[model samples]
Target chain A: MTKLFIPLDSFAVACGADTIAEEFKRLVADRKLSIEIVRNGSRGMAWLEPMIEVETPDGRIAYGPIEPGEAETLVDAGVLSGAGHEKRIGKVEEHPFFRAQTRHTFKRCGITDPLSLDDYKAHGGLKGLERAIGIGAETVIAEVTDSGLRGRGGAGFPTGIKWKTVAEAKGARKYIVANADEGDSGTFADRMIMEGDPYCLIEGMAIAGVATGATKGYIYLRSEYPVAIDVMREAISRAHQAGVLGASVLGSAHVFDIEVRVGAGAYVCGEETSLLDSLEGKRGQVRFKPPLPAIQGLFGMPTVINNVITLASTPEILSAGAAAYKDMGMGRSRGTIPIQLGGNVRHGGLFEAPFGMTLGEIVNEIGGGTASGRPVRAVQVGGPLGAYFPVSLFDTPFDYEAFAAKDGLIGHAGIVVFDDTVDMMAQAKFAFEFCAIESCGKCTPCRVGAVRGYETVKKIIDGEHPAENLVLVEDLCNTMKFGSLCALGGFTPYPVMSAIRHFPEDFHGEPMRVAAE
Target chain B: MVFQARYDEAEAAEIIGEHRHLEGPLLPILHGIQERFGHVSEEAVRQVAAALNLTRAEVHGVVTFYHDFRKAPAGRHVLKVCRAEACQAAGGDAIAGAIETALGVKFGETTPDGQVTLEAVYCLGLCATAPSAMLDRRIVGRLSEAKIGALVEEARL
Candidate 1:
């Protein structure tokens, strides 16, 4: 039977891919067509979603943004033979969006069947785990250290160093926790990975388990991502059944089993300590550090906590060799980063590239500017905690250090674009509001200061002694920056301060004040 | 009208018992209770606290800390509108006003007729097609006034 590929991923389903899939199935059954439908993950070019691929002699031909009603038209136009039609976008590989990406971590995402173990292995999967098991624990740590891989989750700390700490820390039962509480706005790379190639995560976590001698692991996922939770649970069960997980992994002496823990809609749970708290069936609040999670974590044992991307990226680093992974990018940010282009961008999706590209190249070149066809005003790199950059800073390269130099962050590499119509002051206010709502109420600066910050921003917006309120807002931000225990309150200043500095005009006047007005 | 099931102590105990063996079972137990009953009642919290050997305050604190947990039953349909940066950049602020006006209910308020409960969420990760909303558990993206109106009407029916 001829293979027909369609994405059953959440993004595709949200964009009506399910309806299209159903329509295709109906057509196949009614017409007695010799075609088998394979559900795949999204290609990350979300604009072209409901993207259908037909395996032909010329390779997989692409057609997309297809509706259920268009199935008949596609069939009539001989889509089965890769015949050209208005909807046909030619070979999938040649598409500029796909061509531009240097997909390392997401290599098998759109190409292979997500849940199929055979499909995963066929596309160079488990090779890393196989190699890792052969090299043993000490060598695996050394290889990771040599690769200079840093945590992809916000803080860019050296991943090898963290693993070494957890490896050496004494405990009867050490734990490896995969922080999947991805609450950041303009970010979905983690979600995509979990839903796409879950085995890679399992493989990555397994490598950590073997390297660190941890027998158990837990994935602390957010409740918002119901689909991810379901997919991961299924994937873990499959892995256990296939002997890739549980006792005697891959028929080796090592044993590692994983559990899925769901967070109850707390963004603060994304923080390492807070995640641990939530994992332990308590309130998702930040814990005071000095006895950092590496040394003493999760049930008072040494635990290795790494973000989803950081863990998912490990298999390739091991299989491809450290030097090969190290040679890809500029500066300290080695290896490819999956940049999620979102918000008002014309071509918003997940774009994986090495870290040297400038923001202007990403927003204007890759993203094709704003979807509204308006002039780009500002872009918020990272999540809500990241600073909003005016178009003037678009020349900044997509590096962690480079972004930090400008008081910005590359947190999760989620870039949210805004057109000229945006009001920076309102964006600033929302940051404070988000912090206040999501704060775990563990520390006064984040808990109380955020509320004060929100009120201060409102005062400025109300034009109540605008200059005085601005100063007050600055003071409150400084307190929160210095006093908050975690990034929740600390980095809330990035958006607030950046807005006041870059777009003073918006704060100087009444609410909804535009630059032109 | 909104469906409100009276909290059953026996049912809560069974749900709690099912998850008690897990490493950290309180969250799963609480989630299970909420899932079955639509909301976690004060009585359920008391029972959970007793079973877990924790204070009532501790259980209450956990429930209130997270946004997903509800203290009371929601309307027939819960409509969560995205109010994050991505949605805001795509006219989400304006859409918020439009939705509130159309439904005659503000964010976090249930409609008087109990057909819809409006809530504001940070992001739905549907940034590519911004101005997204979740009606029940289904995400609808690239929203407009007409589309939201149709969704509200469908929910009402």
Candidate 2:
């Protein structure tokens, strides 16, 4: 039997499409037409939704944003026989937006129904888990290590090293924790993962459990992303039903499970230790890490804590083999980055690409420049803590070493673009005050220095004793950077310093408008 | 820190007990207590501390640590204006000024009428709809100073 597959893509309008695909299926059954109807995730070319893609020798033909009323015409027009609307985007793969992405983690995103297991399998979803299940723990760790996949949650720490630490640690009660607290300014990759490909994260966590000997896993989510939390929980529950997460997963010796924990409203909980602190029924505070979470974490047990992106990248690395994952990026920053272009950018969304792409390329070529159409003046990489880059250094590559070489860190791959209209002083102050508000207050330098830094920056902007406050502010940042307990306090200097370095004129204000130092 | 005037031990216990068995239930418990009693009571924190076998300092550390978990109750409505770079680029300062002028209260302070509490939300992920303000968890995007008052008023806090 020569079979045909027709995918009806519409979520909000699914009730209508349901009737149509059903009729199409009924019509097929009645006419003895060999056809398969599948409900898939939106192609994101939302204008052309309720789209039906029918397979044939030529390629899949597209007909979309179709009303139930138009379903019959589409079918009559032989949409099932590789026919489509004249206005169709044509081949899904040929579409520029879909083609632009180097989608490793999000390969199947927007292509399959987020809720359907059968559709997910049809798209090569659990093959990674099935492949990973057969591999030994050491081999799994080696492949990930070779992949050089780093934590995409701001800090580019080697994910394989983190997993290896827990895998090597002696513990019967180990835990794998995924931080879905994407509270950063211009980041949604984590939220997108939870919404679009939640099963990927579940599979990654389960794979981490199999690798690290962790039986229990938990995803700590910030309350801001209520949708992700709901979707992730549902995915996790379904995993349990499918025997993908529960004891002896996929009928193997590996036993794993996950539960979702909601953060009431804490951004600091996105930090791993703070997340564990919140997980342990305490306030979200950073712990002084000598023992590290891998050795002793989350109930004082050995834990493999990784950001959502870090874990999500793992299943693909293990499944595709390290060479395939590693072959993409430059130098030590292997594997593709799912950079989230947020803020004033025109085409802001998740763009997965190789590491060597320049800031200018990402902002201009992929991002289509600032949404306001003004000259792109500055960009803050990572999150609030990342430094602002001036137009002078737009050639900087998207990598840990590259960003660090330019005195910045790819903290979570969150790139916030700004047009010429932004004031540097205010954004600089937010970094300091963010540190102040979210500080654990365990260290005097961060607790005291952050407030001091905020005030000094305010003084600089006010232009009262400008030179003195500028000196004092730099001094405060230096103290906090060097003396603080963790990155929260340490990295606040990146933005403040860069704003001063790049946009010194903004801090100086009009020279005539300035007061005495 | 003054003890909350409306702190009820039984109610707080009921709230804490509800999510006690949940995984990492601290945040939900804290949220529940804050929701019921107008603020997180010392008694409740102590109860959490005791229930979880954690030190009061640890519970306090967690409470004082995150910007979201309040040691005290929030105002009837939360008006969170985006203060991140994306919003700023799209004119967040003007919106903030208008809100400050309208509410007669600065960021983090609740208006005396208990109508609204103005806070800074770093990013609402509605950057495409920049210059956004979240009115008590409901995201309102593509905002301006002129539009903020009506949006704030619509919340009826």
Candidate 3:
């Protein structure tokens, strides 16, 4: 019997994958064809979503972005035999979009049955936990330490050091928290992992638990991702049943279990401390540092808080050993980063590769320029708090240190491209507006300064003392950058100041164009 | 219009009991009440506060802080349009204005007949497609004027 693969990833479903799947199933049943339909994760080529694959003697042939009513046309054209169709994109792995780069963390995302433990294991899923358990906690920590793995959750802190701190902290209970509150606009890697290869995260968390002696874990997922929440909850339950979780993980002496805690739409909660407070049933507000989360976190117990990709990256690190991951990247940034390319890009999707790829290569070459077929104006590499880079700065490498040196951040690695028609002044105002809306109101500089920032930018747009207002905007950003409690306020300046610095013409020119028009 | 019964004391308590055992059960309990009752009413908030042994101020603060929990019942259908940067980059502003004109209501407003409620969401994590929206549980991506019109029609139905 032949098998057909369709993605259940949220992006795919949003693009009408569910309807297409139903159509395929109806067609398959009507003909009573000896065919099996498998609901797999997305291939990350989101442009080609609702993309389906057919099992052939040579390989799985791909076709996609299939319309709601196109399944019948495909079947009639001998799709079951991998026959030629206008929609066919050849083998997915061989596509230029996919064939170019590394795919360690996302290796199993699109290929495997998202919920099948058997499929997960077949794709080398739990080997990290196995290695961690076999090697013991200290060696597990050592492996991660030697791997040079840093947090993929924008901060870029060393994961091994965080685990080491938690392992050594004097607490009766330790917790491992995965920040699934991927509130960044252009980023969805965390949501993709949670929906596509949830087992990868579970296994990674289990390894963290084993490594740091943390007995319990929680995934503070955003409520925006209802699909991820449902999928993660089910995946956790299944893991418990399969002995991959629970009192004795994999039937070992080490005890570890995980639960899914949904956030109530607070973006600030993506900050680790606020997430802890939200998990504790309190208002999600940023807590002041000094008692860092690793030292005193989640009910004052030692905790290891990492992003979804940070934890998801661990299974492969432990399974493949530290050196295997260590040898992959450049400078201080080691290992592959899953770069989410979005906005006006023609070929928008996830691209995971080692650090040091130039921004120019990523936006122009890999992304195939803008979808509008217009001149590329700006690319915002990172989430809301990231700096906007002009085409002149496209030569900048996609590394944490390099970005930081450029007064930018590789925040969550979400690159949203913009065409020349964009209004930078409006974008600058939106940076403040977004900060004002999402600010936790815990710190004065952020809470009050953001409102002031928005007003000042509006003044500049209105040509009210453009020179003075511009100075005021810079002055306000400086205060927020230095005084704010967390990244929400601190990094708001990146977008605001970068917009002013690079696109000075927008700030000074004839009456600023309205963004909504 | 979708008919939702006013919050009942006993039913709210029962919903609270189901999630009370979990660690930090307030959010879950609140979610359960809203899931069953369509929105977290003042009475339900009081019930949750008393059940969780916390003050109403604390519970109310939490309820207000997060954007997800609603204080009253929405229209029969809720349509959330993405107002975030990625969506805005994909001509979302025009789409948003078009939908508001078609529905005769702005963001955060419900239609006169209670057919649909309009909302603005930051991001739905479908940036690769850009310009996404969620009509209740079903998320739609690559949203255009035509698609938004269809979504509003579906919601009205």
Scored by TM-score, the top model is 3
Q: Write the per-residue lDDT of candidate 1 for residues A1-517, one digit (tens) a residue.
A: 8899988776777777778889999999999999999988888988788789999988999898786588888998999879988889888779898899899999999899889999999999999999999999999999999888899889999999999999999999989999998888999999889988899999999999989999999999887776788889999999999999999989999999999998888889999999998899899889999798989999989999999999999999999999988998899999889999888899988999988899999999999999999999999999999999999999999999999998899999999999999988888889999999999998999999999999988887787888778878888888999999999999999999888877777887423222231
Candidate no. 3 TM-score: 0.98
Where is model 3 chain A poorest over a 10-residue stretch in terms of lDDT? Answer: A508-517
TM-score of candidate 1 to 2 decimals: 0.97
Sort by DockQ, best first. Answer: 3, 1, 2
Residues A1-517, candidate 3: write the lDDT tens digits: 8889988898889988899989989998898989898988887988888789999997999998887888888999998899998888889889998998799999999898899999999989898899899999999999999999999989999999999999999998999999999999899999998888999999999999999999999999998898899889999999999999998899899899999998888889999999999999999999989799999999999999999999999999999999989998889999999999998889999888999899999999989999899989998878899999999999899999999988899989999999999999999999999999999998999999999999999998898999878878888888999999999999999999889888889997533222231
Model 3 steric clash pairs: none
Please name the candidate that would achieve the greatest lDDT relative to the true structure: 3
Residues B1-157 of candidate 2 have per-residue lDDT tens digits of 1123487778777887899888677777887777666677678779888987878987887676666667666777777887876677667778888888888899989888777778887776545446777676455655766677687677444
**Runs of candidate 1 exceeding 4 Å displacement:** A509-517, B1-4
Q: Which parts of model 3 are misplaced by more than 4 Å?
A: A510-517, B1-3
What is the lDDT of every predicted structure here? Answer: 0.89, 0.76, 0.91
> Distance (Å) between predicted and true CA of A196, model 1?
1.1
Which stretches in model 2 have alpha-carbon errors above 4 Å? A1-93, A509-517, B1-14, B22-24, B34-39, B46-61, B71-76, B99-105, B111-113, B144-150
